[model samples]
Target chain A: MSRSVKKDTLLKVAESLFYEHGFRGVGLKQIINEANVATMTLYNHFSSKENLIEEVLKQREERYWSYLDAHVEMESDSPFILAAEAHGRFLKEESYKGCMFLRAIEDYGEMDNNIEKIARGHKQKLLEYFQQLAHRKGKNNEKDLANQFTLLLEGTTSMTPLIGAEKATEYSIAMARTLVQHTS
Target chain B: MSRSVKKDTLLKVAESLFYEHGFRGVGLKQIINEANVATMTLYNHFSSKENLIEEVLKQREERYWSYLDAHVEMESDSPFILAAEAHGRFLKEESYKGCMFLRAIEDYGEMDNNIEKIARGHKQKLLEYFQQLAHRKGKNNEKDLANQFTLLLEGTTSMTPLIGAEKATEYSIAMARTLVQHTS
Candidate 1:
């Protein structure tokens, strides 16, 4: 395989293992063995385990944004409803683990400043994305609305694995509608 | 120390270490070392690391309920607000790691059936607690209201570690008030 393909394969395996078992639980050897790559290949692609985790987080964030963007392209609901449904759909379709970013912070927040920074930055960006959506909806007190929206989304993500994803999604969207209508 | 005192010390030290570092991240050796107890003492009291974790979760749940009960006794707010404020205060006063039960589920869900069961049971009980609070408040749709209340609380818990606990708590209570008023 080409070097790029090898790198992608490594990332795919690493992300899957890390998500299932967490950053600390899964090791570099397991990632390499799963990817069917040599130890040298893993080292060549990422400098350290921390670097690999950082790359995985960055890739995951991009994929999340893409999921939201794809939903916007297909749905014509109001921005608030559209965002909520998009997020809900993402939760249902994904494997329904808790938020990977938050998990990353939980694992590495104290030990690694860089990892925590990336995790916090990802969440902050999501909050800002909600702010933009609320702005597009022309809601009064858009910042406050965005914060509530973020909370609901975070709640939905956290609750999905325990409660079924479908129920969690339904309740989240229903609450989002109530919050939006009450504010309006 | 007395047997009970030794047990309490072990539980306290174990809880703190597990909260700061996850279950997999912190080892039994570290727990015993911190508690100044022997390995045999830990095993004698709890049988295994998993049992130790289960006891810690049970104690934490009791502490959480006591916090809410204390608040209800001291304040005259509606049940919904009382529960929300109590939870908010719990997050603020505690060191504010992510939800320990959910974290347990994440770490041990795949590997340990009993751990996952205990975690899920704890969450279900919290949901029921919310339902009782909603019923007391005479909400028209108490079940749905309770679900929303649980989501907001979960959201607040997840967000508290990222945003300051104060802001997360304030937003949660405000949103809880809106949810209660709307449902009523």
Candidate 2:
């Protein structure tokens, strides 16, 4: 296999493992073994475990944004509703283990500044996306609305593990609709 | 130290360590060393690390309830607003590492059934607490209201690390007030 293909394979295996069992719960050996790559190949691609995790998070964030962007392009609902449905669909179809970015912060926040920065940046970017959506919608107090919208989405993600994703999403979207109507 | 005092010390030290470093991050040796207790004493009281974590969660749940109850007893606001303020205060004053019970599930959910059960049960009970408050307030659709309220609180907790506890709390309470008024 080409080096890029091998690297992609390693990231795919590592992301799944980290999502199922947290970043700390799995190790480099397990990632390599699961990826069916030699130890040297793993090191050659990522340099270090921290570097590998950082790569996985970066890739995951890209996929998440692309996923949301796709939904935004096709949907006709108001922005908040569109965003809520998009996020809820991601939760249902993707992994229900919770937000991987937040999980990364939980796993490595105290120990690794780099991981925390990346994770926090991912969330900050999402917040900005919401702000932009609100602006396009021409809503008053767009920042507060975006913040509340983000909270509901975050709440949906956090509650997914306890309440099933379907119910969590339902409640979140319902509240999102309520908030939008009430604010308008 | 007396046997019971040693047990309390062990639980206290374990809880703090687990909150700061996560359950999987810290080990039994570190817990015992921090508590200034012998290894044998820890094993004798809790029988295992899992049991020790279980006890810590139980005690934490009790303390959390007592804190909320104290606020409930003293406050005169509407149920949702009062609950939001009380939960926000807990997030601000307590460790902002996020909800410890949810963190417990995140840390040990896949590996240990007992831990997951206790952690999930803690969340369920909180939901029911919201339900009861809504019912007492003579609200229609009490169940739905409670679920939304829980989501906002969970959102506040999840967002605390990113947004800071104060801002997260302020946003949560503001949204909660909007929700209550809108629903009423």
Candidate 3:
């Protein structure tokens, strides 16, 4: 395989493993073996496991937004419900591992600055998207409504694995509707 | 030292390490080394690392309730606000290690049934407390109010390390107030 194809294979395999088991749970050897790439090839592509993790995170961010983009059609409906519906659908997908950013924060927040930055950045960007939706909807206080909706979204994400994703998303969608009604 | 004292020391040391790193991040050897206890002594107290982890979680549950009890006087004010305030205070404390239960769920939710049970039980109990308080406050839809408040509380817990506990708590408290007023 070419260098770029090998690198993509590494990212794809490692991302699956990292999502299934946490960052600390999976090691470089496991990733290399699973990716079917030689150890030297792995090292040549990424300087270190940490660098590979950062790349995985960057790729995950792209994947997540891409997933959201496919589900959300901006021209069709209210941005608020459209965004909520998109997330609710995303939560139920077969490949839906829980929020990778939240997992990253939980796994590496205390130990790794770069991981924490990337994870926090993902959350901030999502919050900004919600703020944009809230503003477009013309809520009296867009920021406050955005904050509440974001909390509901975060709560649903954190609770899904325990309560099951569909139920959690249902509750979150209902709560979001209530908040939108109250504020709008 | 007495056997019980040795066991307590192991739990304390292990708990700290588990909280800083994750369940998979720390190992039995590290726990024994950090606690300065013999391998035999550690095994005598707990059959395996899994058992030790369960005990640590049980002890953590007790410690968390005790900490909350210290701050919340059921008769002094609205139990809802008081409990939320107690949690907000706990979140700001130096030893605040994110919700141990939440961390446990995130860590072992897939592989370990016992861990998921304990974590889910903790959340259920907190929700019941919120329900009882909502009943006391005479909300028309006490259960719904309780659920909303619980979501805010859970969201605050999950987001604290990223957003800073104080800000997270402030948002939760404000949202809780809004929910309470709406339902009352």
Global lDDT of each model? 0.83, 0.84, 0.74
Higher-ranked by DockQ: 1 or 3? 1
| lDDT for each residue of candidate 1 in A1-184, tens digit (9 for 90 to 100) | 4459999999899988888888888989999999999999999989999999999988888888887887764224467677777888878776577888888888787785677899999888888877777777676677787787888888988888877778888888888777778775
- TM-scores computed on chain B for all candidates: 0.91, 0.92, 0.87
- Could you give the candidate ranking by lDDT, starting with the highest? 2, 1, 3
For candidate 2, write residues B84-137 as lDDT tens digits. Answer: 888888888885767788777876777757988898999999989888888877
Number of colliding residue pairs in each model: 0, 0, 0
In model 3, the clashing pairs are none
DockQ winner = 1
Answer with 1 or 2, whichever has the higher TM-score: 2
Better of 2 and 3 by DockQ: 2
Q: Which stretches of candidate 1 lie over 4 Å from their true place?
A: A1-3, A73-77, A138-140, B1-3, B73-77, B137-140
Which ten residues in a row are the worst by lDDT in model 2 chain A?
A: A71-80
Cα lDDT of model 3 by residue, B67-106, tens digit: 6788776655557776777788767763334567776766
Which number leads on TM-score? 2
Off by over 4 Å in 3: A1-6, A29-41, A70-78, A94-98, A133-146, B1-3, B28-41, B67-78, B94-97, B131-147
Every model's TM-score: 0.91, 0.92, 0.81
lDDT of 3 by residue, A108-176 (tens): 777757888898898889878877776666666766666767767777766666566787777677766
| Candidate with maximal lDDT | 2
